[model samples]
Target: MRKHWKSSAVSIAIATSLTLAGCSSGSGTNDKENVSSAAPSSQSSGGVSESGFPIVPEPIKLKMFTRIAPVNGPFKDMPVFQDYEKMTNIHVDFIEAPTDGFAEKKNLLFASNELPDAIYRSGLSPLEATRYGASGQLIPLEDLIEQYAPNLKALMEQYPEIRAGITTPEGHIYAIPGIVTLAAARTDKKWINKAWLDKLNLKVPETTDELYETLVAFRDQDPNDNGQKDELPMTARAGLSVVTMMSGSFGLDQQLGYNINIDNDQVQIWMGDERNKEMLMYLNKLYKEKLLDPELFSHKEADFLAKQGSGKTGFFFDQTNNNFLPIQDQYVGIAPPAGPHGDRLQAQTAPIARDFGAFAITDVNKYPEATMRWIDYFYSDEGSTLLRFGREGEHYVLKDGIPYYTDEYSTAENQPKITPYAGGGAPHIISDQVASYINPPQVQEAQKQLDPYMPKVKYGAPMFDEETAQRVNVLRNDMDKYYEEQSTKFIAGALGFDKWDEFQSTLKKMGLEELQQIYQEAYDKTK
Candidate 1:
């Protein structure tokens, strides 16, 4: 409701652990301090009060297992957490791991049964959240949200997708998500080189046929003006992910891979569909015609960036073309072209509630209510401002109603020393208003082309019950690999569509029907 994301079908993306930051209410206090700005009368004598500071009468310490973003300092050193400790009189022993190695360490902690009190920036998949939640390793959070999470509760009521995304089929909310309402932060951008388009006197393509004609013009004519046919009309690296972005134009929803799509409230596997075959045929045409990157399936990131840097790429995709620096100015974001059926959508763009496991309480936690209270503050506007932007007067200041970083805190050298205002994904609610404050102007402008096409009701990553998860996992482990291989072959012209019926039969034999059934069951409950 806050950003109106619930009006659409928002899929929950898997997000995990991240580390500490601080919030200041002007005064700083020791981590072990028992005093708070709020008077102690409103607080409970032995537990968390209904309102106010010093959540516990006596100082309490929580052990949190989290991972630090490379930009931010240790959680123990962050003034936000320190100031928070002072306000609540709750000391936390933050056990942090490096971003690169966090996943392994997090898994080990669970495997050893030596869990901390709670997890912050915890990167749990929907399946993992459901599995651990069902097993009682991660505690249920619905009751806690009802009692101690007024801000989160209000948001959930306003935006039901937030509730839908995190709630397990069995009715457990195992994790707290990091909410981002910025449109620019959501999807991989489709950037077309407008400079090239202008050189060839072409309008920006608005349909699949127009796009093909544009690519043909780009290939046949030297739009780059180098006099040699060196331009790559459309280029991408080795992955079906590019195809995922392109599939929406073909009237398919292929967001998070596995060729999974939903149509008319029913789960439909698109891998064997004729539409998918049509999409592949189009791709194969590009590959054979030399309009696509000849090494589409083998190029590394370095080579990909190098191509864009050379400024000869007619169309390509990326989260941001910041990698292509000065040359990126030649390009502008383009919405997906309409297909034969007038289907034009961006299935990839994310919802306001992006990360499903930014924070979670484990069964080992002793003060669940206090922890819930602690995290709930972040969902509030003021609390989110503090958590992400640092202090009002010191780190950033409001000028003409928009937040701007103080000169001292804005520098690259000092920015990371203070907090990760630049790097998000922490467990906080960053509205478009606040989130836009940090984006560079170019990124902000490019997203304008994509915003309108972002789907309102696209399905997201699915969660499963224990039995379903097991069976789904078994089928996916085998089928996913086989699917990738076969699909790549199909795209490369190694496997022809004449085997389309055989591919469908093979997928059914590999239990594709059961996989769709399990997903359908989980999906129906959300509605």
Candidate 2:
């Protein structure tokens, strides 16, 4: 039997101010009260005990929504959830949206006020979370964390940066972020065809000029030995393509083309910097020489993969070489090439290493306390390990304190299905504890090559004031479109470098300064 949440249930009536209500419950039909009565009452003044996992004495169900795994299956049938339920006595109803159009579906769910009890791998932007928390759509979790989530509280204390990264400018935490610290967090890495380098008798490139020469050698020397000029010096399919990695060499870490950088402790729009102009010019030269892929701007992922698979690409960029075809053995991760200005490192991401707001509780949940407690288990060391690696003998095996994936789990073909069950590729905290145990030999080898060049930065998502945030959104849209269009033209020779001054002027006209100012203010506030 089910009952409506009682009047005494704590409600986040945010049209007014942050307030709390009392919790009172009478008898229930079952031995344990269901979610309708249990969540609201237990959420206030410590509804659930602060004890460890298997949070509730009786099993309860909570509805959750998230992006579906690449492998098609019922979310309820996921082995990870089945194990979690067995361990914690909590059942979940999962609503999975396809990755391609998840945001749209999520927004529709929100707009319709048909929210689930919780959203896993929520993909909520900081601005969206802030806006929702400020309204009553999402509840702030400070109270729950302090009173009900010892594991999460300890995590915040141990990693103060995590607290700072997730807390809104208003000093409220609206979501639980996934914290992934591992070799993979190195983020952007450049991979070169090492076999090709050997064929041409060229060393790995250490500078932008050297990289260009290497590309030229690959193009002219017939490194693939097909005797036809078919080798693509470099290729990328993502929007940033190689730009995110290359711009850093020019002393302008213009990530995703926003051009935001810290100079003299202030947010500077690096697109306005002269060094960026040189970088563009250099890229144009590569484009003119046919070293960079001619279809760099328009090529689909399958097209790029075809070239790599056919041994026609000598240089590429990705988080790992393992993602490439069988020829991946020939590719090795290389440092971003140094520019004459002497910057040669991938720009570190914001402090929250993993996707922020990966997990968030919705306002509709009456069992915020129970929900927080259940989620908190995943943040604890033991629980985090379990979620990340799965049952020891079943999914992984330990030898000399290191856990390795079982034979069934080792291959990539098995990972899509296996990892989701282990929470490997899912949105959850994968701390050093998890990484240390689960990182295979190949990953460790890649880590050694990448660690030295990965500079760590502490910028989190910018928290703009409501008015400024709206303006920045408008300006950012126009700025990104204009930047991409102009840069492509210059690289493709459709627009000459003679129009460089006009491009800079256009950026200024598009409110580049105001955009930087808004970001600067937000950055300062974070400090």
Candidate 3:
């Protein structure tokens, strides 16, 4: 769930044959020596009788295929995994790949039947998880969680919605997800240059009309005081720009590209609704008046940040107010402006969210129970603390029983270098309790903006099945490209409401009905 990209390779007959021969030669144990501090015992179960921690006595090794964040260093050298090895008496032979190259390598490994005991951070989608689970490549975890995963079981019981999200229509959980409950739900925070607003003697806009007037004032009067007329009233990058946040004001849920929602237990595409038409009209007005960024459709994140760095941007849409370094204080996070229909919802992330597929045990694994127990620790308070914060005295210091980064691990420059060395950035489950108490002061303060809108946060419905998934992926991909092209035209005044009916018809022709049907079926099954 950290800052990791996806990676892929095709299956080849030669690779599969070679893998089979290698496996048949011997059990896949590496010649690496025991470097952990745990004392080796003769008992395989280690005769240990604890509810959590130290699952077995004799060291059992597991082969794990995982992806490493660029900041997390090499998997084998991470202190967090090493400490976990000692605590669980389970030495993991991590077969890790770079984030960008993991997806391809994972498929190649699976195609070659060279699957390890389990896979971590495999980046599998819900549909892929279902397909693999049904095909027996990925083992079902309902029974395992019931027996060996006390911490995870307790978590599911506490948050039943999470359990529902992960459980497929066929009634099985094929993967374990990272529980992100802290500030995870608030996705669309609009940050304004407070310094610019103060200089212009303007109040924070409370409605869309007021926002427009403010932006117009920003354009007519140089709020930056540079007398160059260079200040952009608002700026956002190419994909999912400020439009995503503003679209919510039009009674549409446009997050995750689907823009589909379950209303009164019925599936519908919010983007296809009449309200979206009005939204686009308003955006076109802004584009015509040059209130919105001129290069918004082609600019990248770097370009947007560069504008912020040069103090040329007045309004920015983002999750945090800390993007512009050295001048971060000039920005302040604020709630989205209310719409005419009083719509003011922000898109919130699902709690049972997996970063692609963070944890899954394969059919080749011989120690399902032990592996389940090993992973369950991460969901526990003690285990999550160790995984997220690392060894207390060494990596961080405890103040009033709460962990805070020491001087060495506090700054941005050193945090990346020290985090991987201390073993804190690896993939692991962190509970809402951990996130609320452990986050730094700035993060906790920004979370206050969610108190008013958190309950109304919009969440997308669950997706399932490989066939439906594949079809939807194709349709969604084609439709997204079309939407971008059409949106640019409409905002640029090249496409107008005169062709709006034609646009709707074209969407229906592009499989809108089929997409809705697929989502409706999945939604009913989940219910």
Best by lDDT: 1
**Residue pairs in clash, model 3:** 7-102, 7-103, 7-104, 8-103, 8-104, 9-104, 45-57, 46-57, 124-357
Q: How many backbone clashes does candidate 2 have?
A: 4
**What is the Cα-based lDDT of residue 152 in candidate 1?**
82
Looking at candidate 2, the ten consecutive residues that score lowest on lDDT are 1-10
Q: For model 3, what is the C-alpha lDDT against the true structure? A: 0.62
Model 2 over residues 126-163: C-alpha lDDT tens digits?
65667777777788988877866776677677667677
- The lDDT per prediction is 0.71, 0.64, 0.62
Ranking by lDDT: 1, 2, 3
The list of candidate 3 runs beyond 4 A from truth reads: 1-50, 184-186, 254-257, 302-311, 352-356, 417-427, 431-433, 436-445, 455-460, 492-494
How do the residues 1-527 of candidate 1 rate in per-residue lDDT, one tens digit apiece? 00112233345533332233221111111111122234553544435766667666567778877767666787776667888788777788877676776667776777666778787776676767787787788899898888778778888888777787777768788988887666676777888889989999999999988998999999998998988988889987667766787887877774332356665667787777787888888888888788778888888867887887788899888766656766767988888888777878776676667776878888877778788877777787666766766777988898766567787875544666665433445787776556534455766676777778776654556556667767777888777877888888888889988888898899899999887887677667665
Q: Tell me how far the alpha carbon of residue 391 in candidate 3 is from the true structure, in angstroms, after superposition.
A: 2.5
lDDT of 3 by residue, 330-377 (tens): 776676677778876554433344333468888888777777767777
Candidate 2 regions exceeding 4 Å error are 1-49, 254-258, 302-311, 348-350, 421-425, 436-439
Q: Tell me how far the alpha carbon of residue 506 in candidate 1 is from the true structure, in angstroms, after superposition.
A: 1.9
Error of 2 at 497 (Å): 1.6
Clash pairs, model 2 backbone: 39-366, 39-367, 40-366, 42-47
